[model samples]
Target: MANSNDSWFQTTAAREIHLEQLKQAERFNGRAAMLGIVIGIITEGLTGAGIAHQIGLGPLVDGYAACRTQFLPFCF
Candidate 1:
């Protein structure tokens, strides 16, 4: 059987390591998100289209609305 003090120390050390890793991951994710937002804003300004339009969702949404209102036979 392991000593109770040794077991407690090992658990505490592992927890500290995981906490550090979590902090580093959060920092990286935040930086990446900010970069993506900046890029999206620049693209929108250059093209005069929103993020959704840039990704081609505008057409799909319009088609869906037309189909619902006019009962089109085929809508894609």
Candidate 2:
């Protein structure tokens, strides 16, 4: 009985720590979402692919297209 109760008490501390960490994660996730919203507004409704292209991923996208067209023609 004593050992069983001891295990339960120990778990509360671990559970509290996990809850604290989850709270911190939620905070950062909200901030990131807000930042994305601001970026979307600034870009005037540019979607993810458009934003990637604007930020210099255009060539990477083009390269992927070239690869698909050449080797894996049925890829994407």
Candidate 3:
């Protein structure tokens, strides 16, 4: 605990770093969310590709068809 006369600067550097990291965390939450969404899209797209392959739609169309879930982002 700190006295009234003491500034937070009086705390250990590790404690200060922890508080800084918390502040940084607030900024990173949105970035993390976006990253998760991107990962989800990629996984879903790969899944679609596997389905296309299983259906034997031919390599070209099937390859594209499989990943169309990902392409939806651009086609929109």
> Candidate 3 — which residues are off by over 4 angstroms?
1-22, 49-76
lDDT of each: 0.85, 0.76, 0.64
Poorest stretch of ten by lDDT in candidate 2: 67-76
lDDT per residue (tens digit) for residues 1-76 in model 3: 5574375555666698899999899779978988877776776587754433444654545356446656333332
Considering TM-score, where higher is better, how would the candidates rank from best to worst? 1, 2, 3
What TM-score would every model get versus the actual structure?
Answer: 0.69, 0.51, 0.33
Where does the lowest 10-residue lDDT sum fall in candidate 1?
65-74
Comparing 1 and 2 on TM-score, the stronger one: 1
Judged by whole-model lDDT over C-alpha atoms, candidate 1 comes out at 0.85
Q: In order, how many clashes per candidate?
A: 0, 0, 1
**Among all candidates shown, the one with the greatest TM-score:** 1
Against the true structure, candidate 3 has what lDDT?
0.64
